[model samples]
Target: MITTRVVKILYVLALIPISLFSLLMAVYGLAWIDDSAAFGYLLLLASPFVWLFQVFATRIVLEFVINQFKISEYLRAIKDKG
Candidate 1:
């Protein structure tokens, strides 16, 4: 069984890259503002939505992983009982 501390650490690890990528995207978009106004506006506007979708997807994946672990733990318990 995975401990709560380990799960928390995994969650944080998973979020780190995502958060960094989002920040980078925002920065890049800001930098582009001087070159192309329309494109820069698009990126700036889309960055938040992209970040949100990424976060949502990550959450779903992490939940699935955690559920798999829980299911396996439960199966193990059942096997031991029987």
Candidate 2:
């Protein structure tokens, strides 16, 4: 369990570069179609928003998993008490 937690943290950290690349690709695609330098510039400027979205998504997922784990633990404890 400890190792799994460590690996998950590392995996999430490793996604930083992947998110940056995705943001760049998105900006490039927008530039290709819209041909608006401003759009590309704005997308680049909002790169942090993309990262923030990823972080929020990751946090939500982890929170859900943790809540599930805690619920299961509580149920087991209740069963044991009974």
Candidate 3:
């Protein structure tokens, strides 16, 4: 329960950068999609890498924030709950 709150907090915080990256990428990449089919296909091909980067970055950031907080207590409490 405690770490649930912690994770939600970290997830919301992490969304800030991820969403900004998405918006920025969309703004710049949309031009390529509108200009030609080839560039649009290229964007499609590169989409997976973009998703991987965002997920990896968000995980790393969430882990970092978790470590910075009193997560050990929550972990212990969770273990006791089980």
If scored against the real structure, what TM-score would every candidate get?
0.82, 0.64, 0.49
TM-score for candidate 2, please give it. 0.64
Q: Please write out the lDDT profile of model 3 over residues 1-82, one tens digit for every residue.
A: 3665878777788767776776566555666777886776576666556766887877887777667665777788899999
Ranking by TM-score: 1, 2, 3
Write out the backbone clash pairs for model 1: none
How many residue pairs clash in each candidate at the backbone level?
A: 0, 0, 0
Model 3 regions lying over 4 Å from their true place: 1-4, 8-35, 70-82
Ranking by lDDT: 1, 2, 3
Shift of residue 35 alpha carbon in model 3, Å? 5.6
Instruction: Show where candidate 2 strays beyond 4 Å.
Output: 1-7, 10-14, 22-35
How does each model score on lDDT? 0.83, 0.71, 0.71
lDDT of 1 by residue, 1-82 (tens): 5554676687788788888888888888899999998888888888888888988887787778788888889999999999
The lowest-lDDT stretch of 10 consecutive residues in candidate 2 is 1-10
